[model samples]
Target chain A: MNFFFGIQNNLFSSKLEIPIFKNDGTFLEETILYKLKIQDLEWKIEIFDKSKKNNFFFHVNSSDVNNNDIFFIGRHENLKKFKSNKLIVLNEFTSLVPHGYHYRSNLRVNINKGGFSSYQSDYPYKMTPVKGSVVTSLASVTNFNADKNYIFFKNIYELPIQENFKIYIVDLKEKKIKTFFEAKTNYSNFFEIKKEYILPEMFLVSKNYVGIPIYISEKNGQISMEHTNPPTSNILNSDRIDIVKKFKRELNEIIN
Target chain B: MKSLIRKIINLDFSIQVRNTLNIIPKGIQKKVSNQSSTSDAFIWRTDNNFTTKFKFSDILKLYFKIKKSHVELHFYSKFNNLITIKKIYDLDFSNEVVISKNLLGGIEDYGVFYAYHIMDEKKSQNISVNNKCYTGFSKDKEFYSFVHGNTLVRTFDYYTNNQNELVQTSFIKNKNYLIQKFFYSSEKNELFFTNPASKSVKFDINGKNFKLKKGHSKLISINDNFVKIRSNCFYFRPIAFTYNEKYFDVYHC
Candidate 1:
């Protein structure tokens, strides 16, 4: 039997951060942030040392993310009160058509909750579009629906299809343990981050093979995982070293 | 558990279909799938680059030969079937046409967005639509409409945007009326319906009004921002206006 197409083939593993604070204060880079405690699917904040200088952290006891049912601990964006937060259950998983040929795991995430705030950011690809050409393999200025945001891979690239993404949520208190979020769910559609808001490096390759990209993004008081696409070496008919150099220059322009 | 169940069902169904088809002869299966062929025009090399050359036929026909290694299980080739062919109007090479490929996908999709209006350095024109963004074209011979996924956003023509450096005008398909057409004024960002259901019907895009009046009930833009609804004899078919300027299709109905 030719059981072709619509099959999830690849495995992507990455870590996501959830930051929590005890009170409203000027968020410093070195602020001692509180952590989270997880018993099954319920999340509770863990109290940390007020004077202890450490990275903003959290905790998750469940090491087997694949076996356990995972949920997002989203805090209220507008509400100053921490108690206004609630757990957003993974209601449904909508599997969009497989966008890549080689790297198969393509999952879009969309989150929903009463108080949870949603923030968006764009991470341009390390490699800019070829000079004098407005289109690139990784990013483009999309005018659809008057959405001027830079679209990083609005659709999946076709050949040498090697890049795909897996989403992982790391507990702030437990730095070693990680959890995976499968976009396919039962109750509601996957929480799809808008294409414009998705930074290209968020789903880039690992350091050993493709050069790893470090993404830096901050919204409200959260120090989210920063990642970007590695310098695009696999572009067809393009010199790998030249692309890497061009991407470095472009990345510097975007960063500075 | 749900995915597992779905997987098992899909496996079972595929097996059944395979077994049923196996009863038929190989020649019959080939006939069923390969209705059209480009044997004479196909050019292939042993490089295994999976690059199969296509032969241009006419304004409406495109002959594609799928390489053996590149034949995807779902048939989404390197081109991904996103080629557009536009017929050249009022040109020296009246038989020539342009071919364009959309740069819609991410880096992994391989090819970049490029349009070739000249086959052999001479001007050519042709137009084609992407099946991903359009629906009902292959099935309906007379009409083509945008997919349901394109209900909110107008169909984008990236080939023209890159080639001509003009504001990209989109095609708004009115599914209700088969003959009535809709074109977007890129400068004004207004949707101009060639035929309105009624004379008083009004259309709005981002607070801009395109009101249809009595007599013609069609919208045409006189200038960048101003659009007037003229009824009979004034309305013309929407063509690629950025590339060809001599075809002054203006009339005051």
Candidate 2:
């Protein structure tokens, strides 16, 4: 029996429901739903619109689903890429290794209530709009929002040392270019604060890291955050920090 | 429970709707602020320091933001002691903005007792929200006497002796429309009958809905059953009663 299933590899455990369109341009509806086996756990998931054969449906047997506290799944694109056309979960038990390369868990966040933010990172190696290019590894990313005039990054200067993150602004409307900030080292993880009213600006980073806060006044360019004690050893490119993505929903939605 | 009582007392049902109405594009909102007779006083944030606190006022200026993490408070007063505050983000069971208003003696009298509303750098003479007055102007009288909220004894522009009111019998003999011409109408849409020679005013609301009308043989100022329009003078004033639905718009000038 020829069976088929889709495997989506993530840097975190569990799965993020990013509804993808089926061949018929809608959700693939499948009856007689069964579990896709990953290690000891068989989580129930559905695949639809078979190629006129139930043979098109099968099971995805990957690493064991050991970690349940997983909330988000992303790729550290600066590391080696994941297996093409395969689904893997990220968790405590999941391998930090790419198909043929070695890597480490570079960032971690603890969000409790909401995660229904509209912003999602595009796996630039495959999804980047630029022409055909080969990416070196999978430790980082750069974002381009259609609504923003500037491409903002916080961890650029620390490119390879800083986990290979790049923050740049591409003017979607004007087709211009603006590079806001990039981390000089792998220590800083930058993202946006969805809420508007908090006087103190917001960005999320691993609590274990000693990264200082940075901000650029929307009213004025006055930006300031924690000054590194050993300022000379700092990998910060700019004193001003920018929020990359705004989290809108509660934490539970973000957590699996 | 005490705080809940305060919320009830200082509530501006008008403002609740105003916030929603603001969301709508300007071209669509035909409904202006409601005709609320009541206004509230509140203790707003005195300063946006590390610690937040403030004094109360019967006259409060408030602005609300939906996406804001914490509500901001700003105060602009010519008075040396300016109060301000910034409330934190604590969304619990019955958390609300803490408020308090001054409990001093209220002011009264007429001719539009002017207090300034400093809006972003511009100073506008905004009358107090609540009618904290010793007495109210009789949209029902001639001379349109300005009575005191405190004494209720001191009179201006009219005979001082009369208590409940200053009558029209004496003033009409010589100055027929002098009250209409000289004395200002705190209200618009003031109804006057020159042929019949009786001064009466009514807010022309929703077709013949006459709320209140009063004046001399010459002129009158009108206040109606609907209070916000009354204080805002949307009804008749100075001249005869005129029905103008467009009067209450704050930004329209």
* lDDT to native, each model: 0.21, 0.20
Deviation in Å, model 2, residue A50 alpha carbon: 20
- Residue A6 in model 1: lDDT: 12
Candidate 1 structure quality by residue, lDDT tens digits, B1-253: 9998656534433433433344211111111111111111011111112121111112111111111111001112223243223333322201211111221222222221121222212113222221111111111111111111011111123233221111111122111111111122432221223321112333443234454332122223333322222222111221111101211111001
Instruction: Indicate the worst ten consecutive residues by lDDT in candidate 2 chain B.
Output: B143-152
Q: In lDDT terms, how accurate is model 2?
A: 0.20
Kindly provide the TM-score of model 1 when superposed on the true structure, using C-alpha atoms: 0.19
lDDT, model 1, position A207: 16
Evaluate every candidate with DockQ and list the scores: 0.01, 0.01
**Best-matching candidate per lDDT:** 1
lDDT of 2 at A255: 19
Candidate 2 docking band: incorrect
For residues B1-253, what per-residue lDDT tens digits would candidate 2 score against the true structure? 9988655533343222332243211111122111111111111111211111121111122111112222223221212122433433432211222122221111111111111111222223221122112111112111111111111111111112111211111111111111111111343434322111112322322223332223212223345422111111111222122222211100000
Scored against the true structure, residue A191 in model 2 reaches a CA lDDT of: 37
- Please give, for residues A157-235, the per-residue lDDT of candidate 1 as tens digits: 1111223332332221222113222321111111223444332122221111122122212122111111222223112
